[model samples]
Target: MRFLGSRGLIAAAALAGTLVTAPAAEAAPASCAVADAMVSAGNYWLEHGTNLAAPDWQNATFHVGNLATVRTTGVSNHKTLPWAKANGYLLQNDPKRPFFPDFEAAGEAYLDLYTYFHPDPPILADLRSRISAEVASVAQGHDDYWNYVDALNMAMPSFARIGLLDQDESILDTMQKLFHHAEKEIGLFDEATGLWYRDARYVGTGTFWARGNGWALAALTKVLQVLPASDPRRPEYLRVFTKMANTLRFTQRGDGFWNSDLLRPWHYGGPESSGTAMFTYGLAWGVNAGILDAARFRPVVDRGWKALSTKALRPDGRFGYVQPVGAAPGPAKPADTAAYGVGAFLLTGQQVANLTPGC
Candidate 1:
């Protein structure tokens, strides 16, 4: 189950008016309720969402988190194997955006299937061809490929995984090159605030988006998850992860959710599940990994799980309040939901499931 990759506060006692004056009494009961809730939501998604093998950013991401759920629950491999086979184990490389990261976002899920199931060699063929081309492109002095913040998670983690799998440090180094371009050359990251702008336009605009930071943090955590502890570059990514975690620790709303506009919560002030679940996933991962102090971050993880399980997730298993795709902060209503949002929840649930009674 270590192919990859805790929590508490029986988020079962969820909402007290969109914003609770104080969080409900929450703790990680011995039941490990988060995992059970995770499976419930996962089943909701499986029944209502698209077929798992659909080649798109949303479904690809769902697959990434769904597989994590499978491992956490010890569910059989029926869905993943058949799906990977139906799709021919290919990455989503659209002809128009040949190197577009979204098109290739499926690489993360594909690689996970290979690692978890140890599928046939053909499972890696599309990644080798397409990502090898990407490596060559980066080597040829092309650093602008990761033009947006989401690309960090959409594609970079897959590159890092391939680097470790192939035992190619150069590919890992190339990933840093692209990250450097986006983080520094493009000035998308704001170290002064320990957050990242969604793209070049959002820089210097005094607007730190919740989902944007969620995407960046999840990517950093994913990279660390797959990187060797002894790798010299591990600390660099580790610093970025902890700094962002520290910033988020202060900005979380009282109701256990982060508003879409992080600093200016008034912009779209409400419980946003996509960003909240993703942030929760990263914090839980950091704590379980021992890079983040448990005392400092466990409360944040607790509040987040409570909010998601209680507030955003509907009784019928629909995880809602996800702001529709955009570059800036926007309002998310209870009825608003997507596969990607549910995917973030699934990822969060697996991590929360690992928490040992929140201590």
Candidate 2:
């Protein structure tokens, strides 16, 4: 996986000792087996590591991805889902302060679990109120509220999910408006490549930071999933997604991972599993959703899944090569795993499992 600097491989070996070797010879035979194993690795981390039940976005991201992993595999890790429900889906932030995107990210799991069951979930009460208020604020011309690209992953799906569940078109409408205002009006997207700048500063350099575009692509897939086909804004969402899907097509490394910076490969050049997993997740979802051509995206998904399993997934279940928490493109080592990185890995595995075999 072509990393950014001269020390990239040396750094990877130093930190992620797991990446230096392969799994046992008796590894699973089927692709689904690999996917299931990846899920198990994630469950192990959440269950045993310090990541479980944390209210912050880092842990929240993992839990949200945990939901997808369990839902797709039909195997719930008793530790995470029930714990989230028991805690009322909250973390370090108070419900009283709801506008922060990171605080609201946990609601993705809450709403998913709420929908998984039949009736209107009681757990939705607190989150619903906070999200509604936030959406209302944006509806009143707070279009640029999500100024950062990360906010898209942190909050977009919650709004779209709530809108779809309640049959409230206004909520979906306001959510789309806010996304366009931040991305398009703010000029975060590079029209030629279909990727996004990490923020306003990176826009000047037109750098396509991997995780930044990963957030945009993954969040776009989420928004497309919840928005009704009949909705007027659906086409615009698909258009944006197509551009991203096609752009990411050419930039992936030969080994299937992407560097920290998608465009400037030399910048912080190293295999970042988190960003690769997110792109894998988004691309697989696009193909599954029929928004992307299966013939075109299937190979990308296949190569990405290979890189993830071969290079990122350790035998002990520790997903590695995650970039530490940051707002922009930066260096990441193979051993540098984080909660959000595991989240992205699990989400990608979920979509990989959903893909029709031999596609």
Candidate 3:
């Protein structure tokens, strides 16, 4: 229940000090203050929780977009589906398969909020059990194009956190296995291009999906953060992450966003907010973790923050132009609003909060 004991509290206080010491002149923009606001917002939704499938975007039960709405405005309708169903309970239409990808995203959201708020132990335990059960069920014999990767990414943070809390070796081993499977399945090295593919095999017209790559980049950074420095796999994860980061850097648009299609802009439209936000978060994390050159990445990060703060955010703090859920890059229509887009925005804002003072 109380994962952060005296030692953890001390470490967190030290980390907070490092974060706050950055000069006030470099403070994050006012709108960006919601980065910290998420702790309260997330807690409000969890406490006054609603059903997950009310089709009301204002409730916490809706997808990533709905979550964003809840973060911005704490009032959500009760018609929302219960947390279980909202978090990808199996549908009768697709009974055999769970909505693993959505569960993964929701799991991350819950875990991230938990880190900041240190929610009631029962709340934390319930979420952990649900997520772990979904992951264990999905991992038993499931295989899909990208669902496995999604599940692994979603499960890693929770498992690591749980392991740290209970000294649970099984949890740690599960995390390791998930990572290995994800690397072998989705990760590919291109000798000619010296970049990693979004998946192991390259379709003739295939290029890296910006968000998918973002997911991978973020996952690797998170995994490495928890992995022991001496772990043999740590260096390999770093190597892959570096390669992906370089490719991402070269692909960044002059406007500070990645194109919908990471390889070629001609085929796709302009810069995408969701992918750009994810990449911004990933790059910022890399710099903060000392795995990448901050100077080299700062401009990109700055441009990204400016673009998101100015272009994507509405006056009410709603994030737009997020590409809706899909496996690969597609038409960036105005109608394609997604919760993950807002999630990505929040993620970027959170990182920017840390960067502003430090810069």
Candidate 4:
């Protein structure tokens, strides 16, 4: 029986067998070209969009990071611009969980396109509608749609980006409210550890999943990146960002990758690409943006990027050791790869390029 996925395409599940991994020595150049190498990966994936994972978070992530590469490397905006146009410039939908931020992941790409390549109304029409509806609903009652840490990375930046574009303080206000709810009422965050449990499951288990916290750090970085200078919540966001950076600085493995279980390495200890890339993106942005001290965090970014670009990256742009979709830590083998991991790699590359021009 022939099964079809979205738009009558092969189901995304079929791509699982098509992940294509290379030996650590294969596909890697002796001296990696940060922007060139990353965009090559972006270009490859964009060239083969059909062979990717779930559209909601995974491919959406690739778009966001690839667009960032386009911004930095001056590569052709050919693929994403047309891809966005074909998608009708709307936020991705998940009818089953209509309000879940997982579906909102793609909006980050839309917002990026709106900000840089095209400031067209069609690009933001759906984003504006959904965010407005959300703001109104939030005023009427409480919603815990952002109950998990992963959602923070997926949606908070979208809110902040839209807020910046429309100068809608209400949207920004609502974003802050939900974020704090996750931290306080939901109790997913531990200020003392500077890490957040992926969800309630790991809350008391002494397990701090690396990618989950990395997602949180990436969320904080993106939100702060776009938040207005006069915004009052800057202090809180900065506090969390810095605290996480400090904690991660100590947890990074000697070889540069972060173990899947950061606090407890034995809980599936190994190199995980996505989490390390997220950490690198956050730390590199922190140092480049002057939020992190060069003396302390610069080395961390350097080490993380070195490992990500060399170890995780195959010469042809396929990244390795990417933990597959899941909430908690698990083994991330050298052969495992994902587009979201590629996106994370791009995000880190752009910032790393900013810090070290020749990197």
lDDT of 2 by residue, 1-359 (tens): 01112232233233223244432122122345645665666766865566455667787778767766655554556555676766766634654554877777778767655554323457677677877787788867777768788889888988887776676778878787888877789888778778888878877686778888888888888878766677788897788888998988999998899888887787887788888999999999998888889998999999999988878877778788888888877887767778888888877877787674521
Candidate 4 has its poorest 10 consecutive residues by lDDT at 1-10
Better of 1 and 2 by TM-score: 1
Q: What lDDT does each candidate get? A: 0.80, 0.74, 0.54, 0.79
- Candidates in descending lDDT order: 1, 4, 2, 3
RMSD of each: 9.1, 11.2, 7.0, 10.4
The lowest-lDDT stretch of 10 consecutive residues in candidate 3 is 55-64
TM-scores for all predictions: 0.89, 0.86, 0.69, 0.88
lDDT of 3 by residue, 71-103 (tens): 333323322234434544321222344434434
Q: Write down the worst ten-residue block by lDDT for model 1.
A: 8-17
Per-residue accuracy of model 1 over 1-359 as CA lDDT, tens digit each: 22221111111011001222343233334366676676677778778775455777788778878787766665433566676678888877667677888877878878777765554568878987888888898888888989888889898888887777677778888889889899999998899999999999989998998888898999998999867778787887888899999999999999999989999977889788899999999999999989899999999999999999998988888888989878899999998888889889989987887784531
Q: What is residue 90's positional error in candidate 1, in angstroms?
A: 1.4
Instruction: Enumerate residue pairs that collide in model 1.
Output: 6-351, 6-352, 6-355, 7-352, 9-27, 92-103
Alpha carbon RMSD to native, model 4: 10.4
Ranking by TM-score: 1, 4, 2, 3
Q: List pairs with backbone clashes in candidate 4.
A: 27-315, 28-315
Q: Candidate 3 — which pairs collide?
A: 51-80, 51-81, 51-82, 52-61, 52-80, 52-81, 52-82, 53-81, 64-339, 65-339
Task: Name the top TM-score candidate.
Answer: 1
